[model samples]
Structure formats: C-alpha cells, structure tokens
Target: MDEIKFICECCGKEHESWPAITYNSPSSYSNLSDQEKEEIAVIDSDFCVIKHSDQVDRFIRCVLIQKVNDHCEDLEYGFWVSLSEQSFENYLENFDNENHETQYFGWLSNYIPQYQFTNSIPTTVVTKNGNERPEIFPHQDFDHPFVKDYYNGITKEEAEKRIKKILKN
Candidate 1:
C-alpha cells in the first residue's frame, strides 16, 4: 500500500501517516440545521455541546483503535461520544492538567459506516494521564457487529481498502 497523508486542519501541518478514519463532529451535530448549529451548538476539535429546549447533549472527541487481522497497522478512528454534563465539565476543567486521569460513560455519537445503528452505542471513555486524547471501548456485551469486529479485528485488505476509500483523490 502507498503512504496515506492528510493535512491537519487543527495544526495546519502535514500528517504523513494516518488513522483509518477521522470524523470532524458527531453525527448528532451534523444533523443540526445551519441556524441550529450556530445558535445551539458549541464545538471545537476536542469537545462539543448541543443545547435543546429541554436537554443539553454534551460530547467529546475520542480515539478507538481497531485491530486489523494479520496486519501491521491497526485501524484507528477519531470519533465522538456524548457525555454527561458532569463528565464534560470535568474533562474541560482538567484539559490543561497533564496528570489528570478519569473515566466516563458515553454514547457513541458518530454513525460509522460499517456500524450504522439506529441508536447510539454504550462506551467507556478513558482519560489518560498525558496529552493523548481519551480512548473509548465499546461495552463488551453490546449486541452489535461493530463491537464484535472491534474485538475480533478485521482483515488487512479490508483495513487498507477502507482507508483508500476514505482518503480519495
């Protein structure tokens, strides 16, 4: 396979290597209307919040690494998840704390292509004691094919194919 590259919009730098997929926002945010997004949603590279008349949906950016069967490179995803207000606040408060460590229950907010479901999936978002983004793990008992593939892994050819398809010319 050829090298995959993407220009980082966040840092305005070139990224030679790449994750299999990276989503800019949660599907919920994407579903909002233009005026709704401007009036009710606050989003950045790491966090997002959508305010509804009766509820506030909070989200955070996270990474999920998927093992590709018989492949040297794993399939990684930069996805989003909905968090409770408390969890979102805590994460935001400790954003600059390199030693902060915690965990939160979240709902997978991105409708990944292969794992598209009617409802958001349950997950555990783990914050590490460093600069790295939080990692999410799907609930093992969740009856979803995506969760199964996440644990069992995908074929190398499938992984490469997905990447090539995503980063099209």
Candidate 2:
C-alpha cells in the first residue's frame, strides 16, 4: 500500500490524494460480501471484486470508473467488475458503436502483452509530448447538399460569418 500522488507536470499543481483504490484488490468488487453488494446496489454503483468463496475459479472482477476515457480531472469513484482475459479481449473486439471504447481498445493493443488484472487504471493528461486527443464528437454530418459543395472550399470569411451568426443567436 504505497502512497499515490498525482502531480500536474505542466502546471506543477498537486492534486488531492484520494483513497487508494485499485481495480485489483481484496476490497475491490466481486470479492465484496452480500452486504456490500446490497449497499452498492442500493446506491446504483458498479465495482470490481471476486467472490472469496470462488477465488479458486481463476477470475478477476472490476468496477471500472465511468470517466475512464475522459479527462482525469473529472474522474470520481466508480463501480467495479471481475473479468477474464478472454472476456476482456472479446469486449475489445466486439464493442458496438461507442467510439470511446474503440479508441481505448486501439490504445490498449500496443500494451496487450503487459496487461494485468491487478494493475491500477491509467489516467490521461495533456502533456508536452502531445498524445492525440480522443474524438470528442460524432463525425460531422454531411447530409446537406451544401456540405458537398462547401467541403473542401470553406473560406475563412464564410467560417467567420457562420460563427458570428451562431454567436449572435
């Protein structure tokens, strides 16, 4: 149980230390008692834990925090779950339409060999090395006929006019 500190490398700001909870721990989800489960269910939260009675079955659970893909500044305590490598791989492979998971899977592929059940969840921050930012919105809708006409030739003046119209409204 080492102390964990998060420092903003750019601004040199020290974030407040939170309770050291990891995805892999005895206190983590699935391992929680029935009472704990009820407590969590009452509050509608998810978490990672293994049933102590079933530890021999070789499975790990996780309650992934909700903002796992967003800016670290907005994260808070989240629920957990138990997952198997095969199941996790399948999840990465079978994500339906959520681009955020797709983005995470892409990022995780390079580190697949180092994947571990007990590892701390990683957080992202803007840094000097400039990692690509995640797509924050859906692809631009181009259903209008005007979009095709304007696609490659959106002039600076037109863009400014559009912005002025939007701001004025």
Candidate 3:
C-alpha cells in the first residue's frame, strides 16, 4: 500500500504515514441499554469522563502501548478525540446528508492526560455522514489552567515519567 503523507494541521508536522480508522456502524453503542447509555453519556469533551477511575488507568496503559507502537511518529500532541455514543448518533442523523460544508459537534470518548492536550484542538475525520467526507469537530473547554498547560508542550521525559507513575500506582 502506498503511504499517505500530509502536513497535519493540528501539530504542524508532516505525517509520513498513519492509519486512520473510523467506526460507522454503531453496533456496539446501539447494543447498550438506556441505563448503560446514561451511565456513559459523556457531558464534557474537554476532559476525560472516566478520569481518576480504574477505567482511565487501563485506557492510559493501552494508549501508551499504541503511542509507542502505532503512532510513534510526530503525533499531534499524542492523542486523538473520538465521538461519544449520543454525539455520534446525532452527527450521523444530521450531517450525513446532502449538505457537506457545515461543521458538526461531537463529544470526546478518548482522552490522554500524558498527551498534555485538551479538546480545543480540532481535526477532520471521515465519517459515514455522506460520502462527501463531512468533518467532525471535538469541542473541548480549556477554561481550566491545567488543560491549557497540557497543550503547551511536554518533554518526552516528562511524558515517560507520567506514564511510569500511572503504571506504578
């Protein structure tokens, strides 16, 4: 397969090649009951809904491996945002139509603290919403001082230290 290269708008670096995956079929989300949906309904895209929870710990570990192995290249601040169940459904219903120029809102399902970047960073993704390739934006609030600082930049050593701490605890 030919490598896809592009200058990333997020990090301002050339992406030699990277795999972009999109899940259009909401089979996983659709299978959940209303109660489960309520339990996991992400209200804020800026921060992790599961932060400080065991789930976050596990997620961080998995993300670390993925960053080290899959996204080893110059990552746009090290993490990418995903859409929440409700937000994704809304996007599919509204934007996957004839109109392809408008922007849609979605919640972040994945958050990496070690990445030191919040939701403010926007990027385009190919979605099922019309074959025209509608872009989905992840809205994040950077009101918190810490959130802003994370986006500033973290040294690789600091990131590794944080990851070790998360793993050790």
Candidate 4:
C-alpha cells in the first residue's frame, strides 16, 4: 500500500509515512455494564481519524464489528470523516482558484472514492457499549457513480458545482 504523511488534526501530532489501522481491543469498553451498554448501544467500539496528508483535513473513521440483529442495516455502522467547521471555512476561502482549491479538494475527491459512501450524515447515538456512535452525513463518496465520474475526469469548478448542489439539501 502507498503511504502518506499527515498532521493529526485531533492530536496536532505530525506523523510521517503511510496510514495504518490502529485497533483498540474489546477491553477498551470492558468497564461498561448492562445498563450502561443499553444507554450506549455498542460494546468495545473504537474510534480513529484518518489524515491523508499534510494539506488535507482529517477524515474520521470510528467503527466496531459484532454479531447483532437490530435496526442497523449491517453488523456495524460507519462514520465517514469530513472537515471540521473551521477547516471547511478555510477550505472555502481558498476555493476561488481551481489550482489552489484542487490542492485541497482534489485530495478530497480522490481520497474518498465512489464506494464506501452512504446518504446518512454523521450523528451521535448511544450504543449498548455505553459509547456514542460517530455519525456521517450524506455526501459524495467513491461509491457514488456520479461522484466517481466527477472525480475521474471533471474539473475542479465542475466538481465544486456538483458538491454545492448536494449541500443545498
């Protein structure tokens, strides 16, 4: 796998090399009891924030896997990461020039492909584990055919326009 360097947005720590998965074990949630688990929903869940590069904002990924038949569509609910409010504002401020904007947004377009995307926004839900589930709102990801088409060939201006349309709703 290709490696990328980035500054940790959550910890402000600089990391060099490729991104890797850091798993937190089940013991991480061992302290929660049945009542607490009901209040939270999940058990032994872990959270991670993905920072693709120095220039790109962090993409948070928090998830857990276990066997359960519930209202959830899958065994796990995933949170797609995005820019923080302040970081998004900064991104907009630099979007006038496609070249400059692409440096940031291009990374976004490419980093998130048309797959692994959902219409849901990031939200907080108490899990059985006594932890809050990380949420992701609707947006284009590598999974969307339109978004895949857009990232594959569309220019920055065109991509921005499409993104704007999605944001309006």
lDDT of 3 by residue, 5-84 (tens): 88867668886553332222222233446775467633322222332234321110001112322233422222334454
Instruction: Write the residue-wise lDDT of candidate 1 on 20-127 in tens digits.
Output: 588899998999999999999999999999999999999999999988777455788999999988999999999889998889999999986655697778999999
TM-score per prediction, in order, is 0.87, 0.22, 0.30, 0.23
**Residue runs of model 2 more than 4 Å from their true location after superposition:** 1-6, 20-59, 68-169
Q: Give residue 73's error in model 2 in angstroms.
A: 3.6
Better of 1 and 3 by lDDT: 1
What lDDT is obtained when candidate 4 is compared to the true structure? 0.34
User: Between the candidate structures 3 and 4, which one is better when assessed by lDDT?
Assistant: 3
For candidate 4, what is the TM-score?
0.23
The clash count of every prediction, one per candidate, is 0, 26, 2, 26
- Model 4: weakest 10-residue lDDT segment is 101-110
The residue ranges of model 3 lying beyond 4 angstroms of the native Cα positions read 1-15, 20-90, 94-98, 113-141, 144-169
Q: Which stretches of candidate 4 lie over 4 Å from their true place?
A: 1-56, 63-80, 85-131, 140-169
Pick by lDDT: which candidate is best?
Answer: 1
Worst 10 residues of 3 by lDDT: 57-66
lDDT of each: 0.87, 0.30, 0.38, 0.34
Candidate 4: residue 148 Cα off by (Å): 13
| Lowest summed lDDT window (length 10), candidate 1 | 11-20
Q: Can you tell me which runs of candidate 1 are displaced by over 4 Å?
A: 1-18
